[model samples]
Target: MRRGAKRLLLGLAAALLLSATAAAGYGWMVYRQAERAAARMYEPLAPAEPPLAYAAIPQPTRVIEAGGGLGTAGSGQSESAGRAAEPVSGPFAFASEARAQPSPEEGDPFTVLMMGVDERAHDRGRSDTMIVLGVNPARGSMLMFNIPRDTRTELVGRGTLDKINHAYAFGGVEMAVRTVERFVGERIDYYVKVNMEGFAELIDLLGGVRVDNPFAFDFEGYHYAAGEIELTGEAALMYARMRWDDPRGDLGRNARQRELLQRLLQRLVSLETLGRTGELLDAAGDHVRTNLTFASMRGLALDYGARLRDVQTTELAGRGRTIDGIWYYEVTREERDRVRRLLADQLR
Candidate 1:
């Protein structure tokens, strides 16, 4: 009623509004800062080889070895160790069968299928590179064992035995995932497949990866001197793709793949990657795919990095052989059993 009284009331209201506005702005700032902190603390997770990228469908025929005896599965173990021993449940049972969610919320291993495809830009190709990785953050260890793309195995969702890589070619990621699951007798939780183009960008992003020159001679204007050398993106691609020049053939190529991976790992771990977070996420979003939620990767990178401060490298034991005019890597039963146990324990 009084003009002076009305003016006083308006002043009080303005003070309250300003206080609330200040509080809200402060809260928003805190949230953004926290997200950035988490992002900065992370290292790129072990790259998911694209083998698991296409698990959305089922294969027509899948490899199932009856009584070949996969693992020495013991009782009273974790689900990962358990999944390592069971048979693939096929596409119909995917979500229910493959528990892609991380239960521990922290320090649980992020399992991914790593696929290296033999195709170039303007060409779509299936993965010729196949490897199963079981990374246990709890154990602070990363383990990868390759599956010979030509391993003689039955393909699930299909009619008969075919080269393992054929599963991806015929059915894409879904068939590829199913085929790998049957071979190792383990449930693949996720995948990140990168081809020649993506590989080149990634190598360049990291400013290049340093690899051990296990072979000599030149290819495509590059000479890989024996021992250790730093490789740029194009050079790294040529370097990683060279197998014919090596004494071991595909075996040498396989070794080179592992080396390329190791160089990435070493580079990722050695740097302060906070500034590159945007570029990193862009690379993963464009070149990588999986059942993994962004939250899941963020959790694993921070949680696992905290627990496992170290990583070790390994390869599968197999002989290169030709079957029906196709080259295949034949892994003996003993090798399967050993890798199974090793991976299971780390994953646990």
Candidate 2:
């Protein structure tokens, strides 16, 4: 895999890890209510306060700027670069418009934009992985949609056609959120951002996670075989980073990432994490960033806890093409509309 692509995929795993944290923690709360003895034993493990929420996450503007790269994905295919129009350059500034916010009521649906970024040397890199998760408590379901990192769209605040991932590079979380809102035609009620390094460390903090590799391959000096495997934080970072050897390319890599996240989440909610509560909180404090407040998270957990049993995952469908010597994923308007309708129904 290209170095740039690897960077993005590694960062992507970090975002997924954080999602698992929320799901697992929420699940514990639900379990506590059903089992008094179990709750008593694990009560001390719960955080005294909710995780911190950041209104403005740090976004460094300086670093060695790197060119964009492309990778294979389940729904999108990469093509060689070709002659194309030049993209506009500048900081993005989008005006806020009136949109529906998340309701405190348990049944109301809310949307969260989860971003994993490859920031190096304090320079904020592009959001390598962008997934919009819609949790619908009323419907007892969750919808997860992956937007290819190379997706080409009107960068909402910047008014230029570029990779959707670039929004974070241009304007941090705010721009990324606006660009996605335009793409999906839905108001994002919250956002979560995770740095790659911190995410890697968090994995190590949990000892390690078990993943079933569908194919055997080597990445970053770590040899992996097809079958069930254990990955330390560092090894897991490489595991999520490698996609070049996979026949499915980006798509196959994404599947493994999802698998790891699912398994890691299951591990998080188990009684085992209770023993490492202090270390877990310390890791989260250093690595994770979110806009969701304690009250909101509690509401989501208590109200939507049982509803989380059903989850549906989907990826944006697009064809990759090179323009102006740059690779871009071109998605159709109809596809955008379809996603919009699906989310609208869920939100309603």
Residues 1-348 of candidate 2 have per-residue lDDT tens digits of 223333333333333333333443545753333232212212111112211221121111222223654333312222323323334332222121233456734466788777777677778877887778777878877676778778877775577777888899998887888778766766677776656655556676677888898888987788998999998877887787787898977666666665665566456545565555455555444445666654454455445553466767666676666554577666665576677667766666
Identify the candidate with maximal TM-score. Answer: 2
- The prediction achieving the highest lDDT against the true structure is 2
Q: What would the per-residue lDDT of candidate 1 be over residues 1-348, giving only the tens digit for each residue?
A: 111111111111111111212222235553344344334333343423323222222112222234763432122222221132222333222221333455434666656676655454555566676767777766677776667566756576784555787887777777777777656656676665544335455446556667778657798788889888987766766665566677877666666666555545544544344444344444544444444443554455444444444555566676554333445455555565577567666666
Judge candidate 1 at residue 40 and give its lDDT. 38
Error of 1 at 151 (Å): 1.9
Clashes of each: 24, 4
After superposition, which runs of candidate 1 have C-alpha atoms over 4 Å from their true positions? 1-101, 118-124, 306-309
lDDT, residue 230, candidate 1: 83
TM-score of each: 0.67, 0.71
* Stretch of 10 with least lDDT, candidate 1: 1-10
